[model samples]
Target: MSSAEKGLRATGLCREFAGRDGSVRKAVDGVDLVVRPGELVSVLGPNGAGKTTTVRMLTGLLLPTSGSITVGGYDMVRQRRRAALACGFSLGGDTGLYPRLTAQQNLSFFGMMYGLRGDRLERRAARLLEEVDLADRAKDAVGSFSRGMKQRLHLARALLHDPAVLILDEPSAGLDPQSAASMRALVARLTGEGRSILLTTHDMREAEELSDRIVLMMGGRIRTESTAADLRLAAADRLGHVVNVAFADGRVPAELEHCPGILGEERDGGTVTLRVTDGAASVEWILKTFPGRTTSVSVTPPTLEEVFLDLVAAS
Candidate 1:
């Protein structure tokens, strides 16, 4: 099948759990998500927003209460094995790796379960270790590896079968800054290779940097789904654009004190920030009005975190 045909799709997915007093708790409500080939979509949500539940259902670990999920065009419930073969998943944490086993050994075991063996398995394991920058530590026990190293090994394990789609759950969670940057670089490479990727992350900056589209979930439902630019644009309608101007003497120009489009303004040490209706016009006006007095000026749309906060607070 073509790569596009192998993209991930979930329609009206839902999962319910039995709670105390025979109450029914819907962990995942009617959620629909799609990740096309050569694209990356990030799912962002606070704790208990059903991201994990939805991911489990999509990956065939948990069957949906009522919905359909397809990976590489294979049904997740009916043709699970086939779907699994077409999908590679890396779930964060320290659960999958065997502490005493070497990295190479770990890959070999998983490969065998995937029906790989002999020279093919060995070569695949070696290549993956190299790809994840763990080739030199191939024979070292997994327990000896760092958290970031183990996380990369998890990614290597997921790619053993060369699946067409990838699902990553907080791939960089708990990673140090340098390690997280490395992991993000690796994920970016995967996206460049034209595989469909669905990433669930709490890092708004990471999502903003990596995703082609972002889906924000709240209370087991999607609050919004769109490109990062579009999300910011949508927020601008409600909160307006944010502009920060740095002045040499920390003074607010009298010209801008009563500017028509300036809805709000605040002052800090050598800096003045404003909330204006039109970003471009406000920026242009600021530059023209301040001239030499303004040292630096920047106009930006609302950040992902700001948008997320607004959604949560409004709800």
Candidate 2:
């Protein structure tokens, strides 16, 4: 199948649960998600946003109350075996690992479940350990490994089947800065190899850095879906523009604090960031009003986290 036809897709996906009082609550309400081949889409949301429920449905773990899911052209609900075979998942945190087993042993076991056997399973297990930088620790029991090491093993297990689509739920969570960076690099490499990836993460930087598209989901529905740049721009339009200014004497002047066209201002060390209705006017006002206090000024889009909070709060 062509790349366009070989990816993960969900249409009108919804999952509802009955509360103790018989009140039905929708955990996921008509969420439509897609990750094209060679692309990575990140889903971001606050707590109880139905992200977990949606992912479970997509992975065939939990059945959707309504809607359809297709992974690599196979119906997830009807052709479950084929859909499962077509997609792999790395669900981070404490899940699906034999703490007493060695890394190689763990991979080998999961590989067999994927129908791999004999020398093929052994070879794939070895290669994957090396790929995740865990070859040296392959013989070590998983229980002894660090959180980051366990995360890498989860990734290796997910890839053992060599599926066409991958789903990662906070693959970098609990890892140190260096380990997180390494995990992100591996995720990026997987997309370049033409595998579609659907990632759900709370880390704003991770979503912004690795995702081709960022999906903002809240109240069990997708509020916005766009590229990082476009999302930032859209958020700016919905709210206001960001103007970062560094003072000339490395000090913010009190006189320029409540200037025109400036919606709000925040001081960060030597730089003063202003949220303005007009980007050009804000910069001009700062320069013309107090040219001596301004050393450098640039209009830039709000950060991804900023965009996320602004949109979520507004919604």
RMSD score of candidate 1 (Å): 1.9
Which segments of candidate 2 are over 4 A away from where they belong?
251-255, 267-270, 290-293
Clashing pairs in 2: none
Residues 1-315, candidate 2: write the lDDT tens digits. Answer: 655458999999999999999999999999998888999999999989889998899999999999999999999999999999998998888667999999999999999888999999999999999999999999999999899999999999999999999999999999999999999999999999999999999999999899999898999999999999999887776677889889867778888766777788899788888889778787888889886777788998778888888877887
Worst 10 residues of 1 by lDDT: 251-260
Worst 10-residue lDDT window for candidate 2 reads 1-10
Clashing pairs in 1: none
Across 80-117, the per-residue lDDT of candidate 1 in tens digits comes to: 99999988998867778998999999999998878889
Candidates in order have lDDT scores of 0.90, 0.90
Error of 2 at 232 (Å): 1.1
